[model samples]
Target: MGQLVNIAAHSFTAQDLLRMERVLLDALEFRVSNVTAFTALHLLVQGLPGTRPPVAALAVYLLELCLLDYTLLEVPPTHQAAAALLLAMHTHGTAGAQAPRLLRLARVEPAALARAAGRLVRIHRDAARPPTEALGALLAPIVSKYSRPSWCHAALCAPLDAVDPAWCSC
Candidate 1:
């Protein structure tokens, strides 16, 4: 799993791989961790270069939104991470060149990334105005956490109604 993460992340440092192995092993022993979407999310954020804090924060916000929807579980974590990064780039108006580069780095097909991103957009819209009070409560923590100055108020940023068409052309 760590090797898969390294491949997706484009990180090949021996020390880093060892550390990831140790962490995974420890988590397995404790029965407290699974290589979930967040794992891929972290690898993308930590391994990629030139990813700004705002982009990272927004990506995190999007992934957290995915956690609220059980349907998103069907999407692979690497795909989810790629989609989140793509959406974040688009939202920040930095997708001009980065989108294609991200596609190459994440090794995800443009159509697949677009589809995953579309789901995130729908999730974002639903989360913006949760249908039920219980759902709202479920969303509150993510919103509040990202709304903080520390997270650059990422949750306050408006979700894109749809993914930019250009991204799907890559």
Candidate 2:
């Protein structure tokens, strides 16, 4: 097993290695995880009403944020995806009540989802503030577009500092 693992490590890209590590962690518990949660979110958003543009935008934003912050990679994609959906729902303000149902459909646990969301919320909040020289390059355009109240009426730019700090602890 160790030999095979070493050989695979030499052949995989950084993203592939990280994904494999996540799978190994999940496999130890004998459960499933949303390795393709990004794809799933893309498809899932289309089925919902009046949520496609904003939700999709937020989801993509969250993914990009995760890419910027390697610490977020510790969380599974399913939980991250769920959190993004919840944030998007919050942005829309129309489906906040449906978060549980939406997460259930995505096969994610609420606690895990909340934890992942907290991290993302912090990322979003921090990225929105000034001294954005590092985060601004990637996030500024997104913040500008989503921050607008008229852009699909998404609430993605709402102050995340107001949310519970516990949401970020995994």
Candidate 3:
């Protein structure tokens, strides 16, 4: 694990994100002194390391965010399309590239986001997380071009800006 973190830390090209990555990835478990145990527990439900398929990393990332914290997954539908655009290419019909990257990235691990992905299905009823004006700035362009989720018209209209470092590698 040290090797993995070291490699990721050194090669990690982003600058502003170092602090967030360190804090989030290194978040400690409340009950267990053993972070490894907690991670293992996370893997049990989420799958990690040898057990975790690379394909599922994205799905697992999102699902874990949802299961552990729903607020993290609460983005406007348009923003969701924009978020998908950030890291991947979407494949909706006639639409040249409207597929969400999460679908593609997580394609490596289909079942990981079983619920999180499903939740995307019912976006209108649910409120999105506060629009991180900083984050929205970054994703606006990508989302603009893509057809996005069929239901993303309302959510995708936020003004564009540079993507926030805290939200992604971008």
Candidate 4:
């Protein structure tokens, strides 16, 4: 039997997710990212187990997305990481645009989603120094936005009046 490597085991931090999201946005914000690119990114992230491994993919994919020829994205380990990196990618006004694609690709389990979100708190604690790039600047916000799953995001995204003190911080 295959030893299913649960992705949550090496969960990504909010800062990590944030940095990744920005790189994705930077790739997509301009003319770089379109629906096809978005879909491709979604396909990439779903295959990877969790958050951290995708960072390397984020860097690689960002370069590929900008360069225009994604043939290299088909390479072995790179393809795998790209899937995971893209899974966590986000942009303003298009935050959940790839949810359906991700759903189809990731088959996200409610338990896994919750577990991953719970793991976000850990990611937050670990992400002390973000990278010095466009993606680096986005670490705080994107992770804050998608660090948790929809259930967590709902409350995290909610107003301070509605938020609980404890879970909100980390």
Candidate 5:
């Protein structure tokens, strides 16, 4: 039988979730090789808040979305991070004219990041759709884990289909 990782394990506490959240934030906001790139994410996400899409959470969700698609793995982490950030901003309907400015600050080309983000969006759309029995079997745990109102705060459950087709209209 396949080994099942029990979510109910005492060792697997909310602290683990907290740590994961911090790690994702760190990865998205500070892990780029260039300090300016990290700073760029910080600047872009700082001011926007309050019942709006959680920028940090969206970035992390997009990262998880990327992980599910093997092709995205081939992209450089910096590019992938940039793409995820852009997708997160777009998903929140906050992208507007900020995409190009942020990309310029990160020293990433807008075209490449847009292509990568498009792929991420497509993957998210596929995953967010109602699943068939086999697909449901695969997605159930992921959905269940992120659906927990207490932990991820449903960040992973937010609708990605809301992403605009232009991705970066700006």
Candidate 6:
């Protein structure tokens, strides 16, 4: 079973599966090297059973944004996944007691998660702006795909205006 199939078993729709397939095919066709983050994103979703569909979708969206920013490569994939989940939970108003458990599961400290989430926030903000001429074509397809209802319109969700300082105290 492929990673996408495993992910689909959890909460993804058929359209989501197809989109993932297309991405993988494109990567293979282009001979893109070092695509571990994309695999990590799928693993993250698979690891967290019972995650709500919307939250998972949002997390996926955040991780995809990370793929576009080379600076985010400094963060570990597990940390990125954790941070994306944290931000998604907060965005969807599903965060609370489960936050600590999530951190524990990802083996990520609160501080690290906070820093990663902060970076994601910045990426999300920049993604919302009209893209630069150089990268516009590259970024448009991804943003547009996630904006659709099939993907929970994740890209359409408002970027976090501010991450709560207290949330990191966990």
Q: List the residue pairs that clash in candidate 2.
A: 91-155
Global Cα lDDT for candidate 4: 0.37
lDDT per residue for candidate 1 within 44-123, as digits (tens), equals 76666788899889898899888878898888889999899888888888877676767777787778888898999888
Candidate 4 residue lDDT tens string, 1-170: 11222354536555666677679888887454334434645455555344243343332333332232234333333233233233234311122434344444544443443333333322332232344465445455554544355323421221111112221111
- lDDT tens digits by residue: candidate 5, 1-170: 11222545555556676677689989889544544324434555553333244655666565665666678766666666676677766666666666666565555665676677777777666657745677656666666665565434534545565445455434
Which stretches in model 4 have alpha-carbon errors above 4 Å?
A: 1-87, 90-93, 129-170
- Top model by lDDT, which number? 1
Model 2 TM-score is 0.60
Model 6 Cα lDDT, one tens digit per residue, 1-170: 35755766757766777788789989889565564645665666676676788888888888888888899879988778888888888888887766766766677777887888899988887777745866766778888999999999998888888777566655
- Arranged by TM-score, best first: 1, 6, 2, 5, 4, 3
How close to the true structure is residue 51 of candidate 1, measured as C-alpha lDDT?
Answer: 85
What local lDDT score does residue 12 receive in model 1, on the 0 to 100 scale? 64
Q: Estimate each model's TM-score.
A: 0.75, 0.60, 0.22, 0.27, 0.56, 0.70
Which consecutive 10 residues in model 1 have the weakest lDDT in total? 30-39
Query: Which ranges in model 5 have alpha carbons more than 4 Å from their true place?
Result: 1-53, 130-132, 150-170
How many clashing residue pairs appear in each of the predictions shown?
A: 0, 1, 15, 7, 0, 0
Q: lDDT scores for all predictions?
A: 0.82, 0.65, 0.33, 0.37, 0.60, 0.79
Q: How large is the C-alpha RMSD of every model relative to the true structure?
A: 8.2, 10.7, 16.8, 19.1, 15.9, 12.4
Where does candidate 1 stray beyond 4 Å?
1-34
Candidates 2 and 6: which is better by TM-score? 6
How do the residues 9-93 of candidate 3 rate in per-residue lDDT, one tens digit apiece?
7554454356666666668532424333124334332321332222233222222223323454443332333332322111111
Record all residue pairs in model 6 with backbone atoms less than 3 Å apart, i.e. clashing: none
- Worst lDDT run of 10 residues, candidate 4, spans 155-164
- The local distance difference test score of model 3 is 0.33
Q: Candidate 5 lDDT (Cα, whole model)?
A: 0.60
User: Local error of candidate 6 at 60, Å?
Assistant: 0.4
